[model samples]
Target: MGPAAAAAAAARPQKASAAGGVPARWVCALCASCFVFGVFVINRIWSVPEPVKLNEKALFVERTQTRLSEVYIPCQRKQNSIHIGEILNHVSQTHDVIMTLDKTISNLEMRLAAARAARATKQEKSLISADSDIELSKVRPKVFFVMGIITAFSSRKRRDSIRETWMPHGENLRRLEKEKGIVVRFVIGHSGTRGSLLDHTVDAEDEQYSDFLRLDHVEGYHELSSKTLIYFSTAVAIWDADFYIKVDDDVHVNIGVLGSTLARHRSKPRIYTGCMKSGPVLAKQGVKYHEPEYWKFGEEGNKYFRHATGQLYAISKELATYLSVNRRLLGFMVHRSQCGAHR
Candidate 1:
């Protein structure tokens, strides 16, 4: 090679290959350009009105998913020199990212809707001003048993099973209310999915059953404490019962036994009764009930603080009120089933 050619070759930046001999700089530049384009598209979409924005976003996601899947499916199945595996992986990751962003946007939209509903309810409450409110003695609901089942958006079958078997509804529900003076309600957060299919399904179920308490939060495994807090707060807002109870959906709650159990503590303030026990803090990463935030409790020797299991638990109106009022001050542990029990 000539000296001039050698000099020219040295001056030009050497192309670095990523996996499967694809240029790393090219991949980086493509990713960066896609990110910028995504941001710009999102900004433009968000500028529309709420109704239009939702429709537009849904359409955009559908089109994008279809296009990306069509483009990547061939690459995913066949081997190629252009790093098809890496491209497939990138596409999969991008889809996940989009889904996550969609969920977040949906949550924000639900919050706004919930705020509006709350405002309307508040207005109605102000108009009544307790003038038309029935006394507890006359109404006969001394205890509000809020079976705050930590359920998901897609768990319609489970909720239906609970409704058909243990928890009564329709005329049977009214009979229970009249006889036992105990009310049962299933609490759930709004859907985290992009479309409101789950939300609408739950709403339709509530219309038929009249037993669901929908909250202004997103449904997820780690959001149990927040959902519980909202459960108590909503209970207090709507009822003047002497006691409030929270139970899970999976637990078969014998309403008769529960009423008897709560009747004993009806007069007691700050009463928190349940099958309480202490368990060892699982510090290991892969164990069942592994504490991801284990350091919050203490060093390695610390056991979890004694708490009422999430299966079935009851609290007095006073304690529920305290929790409802002081939600901001309360610290929430991630493993909600093992904690959040307060006296």
Candidate 2:
């Protein structure tokens, strides 16, 4: 071949070798730059601030132990103060004692309830037996008069006055009972003063006249409502009449007029016949018909509700029976006419 062509071929081999060397140098420079960048990032991460860690569980346990030693341990060491264990023991014992007392009270209450039930049953049975002798089936009474009077052992004068003035006796009473179907009875409670003497006098009076109904309860001014309840109960137990009349011994009633008025309203069982007083309740103490428990009437209104005057009133048989049967619930409220008797 010619010298120029041989030289051109040698130049092509040198250019190929140089191109291969350029790629190897570029790879080495890139590897070196990557290593420098990695070192810089690692140094920056190491230089950054790091948060300190604490053992929180151990700290909490230490604080709790310190509080216990300071408060509870000191309390226990004090001579005058009680310990937690002692207090706990005392509370447990007190609870046991209270529980025992509660059980005892419950037992007593149950026994009392049973006694009351037994007494009620006995009273009902006795009344039924007495009813056979009275021949209640044959002679059903139409009107029953229950007179309220406060009679003591020394108050024979009052009873005598009642008997002589208005109350009919012996054949007159029997004739009235047979013809008009009316019965009059005096209701009284046992006296506190001279009880035995009073009881003997009452017994003697009952033996002679047989018109007195002596209650088992002791007499007192505060027990006026209770006496009224007993009077109703006794009257209902004795007879199932059409109308029941309650009158004070001091008030004289015209039997003819009362019977006529009752005949007109006999069909109406939900009526109460009496002198109803409607006026403002007196707030001052010691006034006649003064309301001692004015607060029960409320703060705004000063007037009293229309209620039957305590002197005399008549109730239907149904109302009388209801009052007698539910005496325990109604006894306190039945006599709240002008003022509270309990007060």
Candidate 3:
């Protein structure tokens, strides 16, 4: 073989080897570039804030705890909204219930008021019907004995019992007044609250019976002496009677016997007749027939002077006139004298 041919063969082999090495180097370079790009992307993904990172497979960025918390907050807000709506619904239901209860109470109150008004109307009608047949005398007549029966507004049942038992009614009462010249009347006074139901009831009763003596004094248990004095004064003013008798509503008396008993003493000028009694003066409070001025009776545990029992008593015209004339002075004296007396 020649030397030139050998050199050509060697050049051909070198050229072929050089051409294969160039292709392999280009492939390596492309692979390295791809790796660098991937690395940069991974670094960018990992370079996020501390709470963000790549998943195990590096397929995508994992949602961090902070992002998950942010998502949960919206869900929590939705839940809270639902809870608030439920509370508002409950409040609305409670309000409806309360309104219903209030309406029911108002209805009950109105019904009660209507019932009370109806009852009052019925009572008024009954009273008017009861008084339809009564006829009363217009002129004041001369009388011999004036009997004042002390009573109170609340003593209607007691007065009824008395009228049913001993007191005359209808024509019999008129006959007694006309023939016997004995005036018997129930004495009462105005109530503390003027023009009240009590006063109206009393006025209605007086219109029906024509047997009530209305006084200007106020009715009270403590002012019994004043009441008695007023009764004497009023009886003396109205009638020319020989005797003025004061009797309690609870007392039972035979009118025939009382008339006879008074007739015997009619001639006396100044006679006071009653059952005499002596009772101890009570110093302590809250006791029955308690005397506030017990010290005026000399001492504690002392007894009152001899005096007539308050249940029934009679005073002649002269004494009654004196009592009427000196009412203020005698009233004070009588109050002092009867301070410790049994009621």
Name the lDDT value of residue 53 in candidate 2.
24
lDDT of 3 by residue, 1-343 (tens): 7999999988998898877775778899999999999999998887775344334434333446667889999999999999999999999999999878866764564345333333332233222232331211112245778899999999999888888999886778888978998888999878788789999999998888888887777778777778777677666555657788989999887999999999997654567889887778777888866777677778788987787877888887666666665564542333444532222
Which stretches in model 3 have alpha-carbon errors above 4 Å? Answer: 1-141, 282-302, 331-343
Rank list by lDDT: 3, 1, 2
Please give the CA lDDT of all the candidate structures.
0.69, 0.65, 0.72
RMSD of each: 35.8, 19.7, 25.8
Model 1: clashing residue pairs?
none
Q: lDDT of model 3 at residue 102?
A: 66
- lDDT for each residue of candidate 2 in 32-137, tens digit (9 for 90 to 100): 9999999999978876543212456667889999988899776667844556668889999999998788667645643454344334423553324544524543
Clash number by candidate, in order: 0, 0, 0
Global lDDT of model 1: 0.69
Whichever of 1 and 3 has more TM-score, that candidate is 1
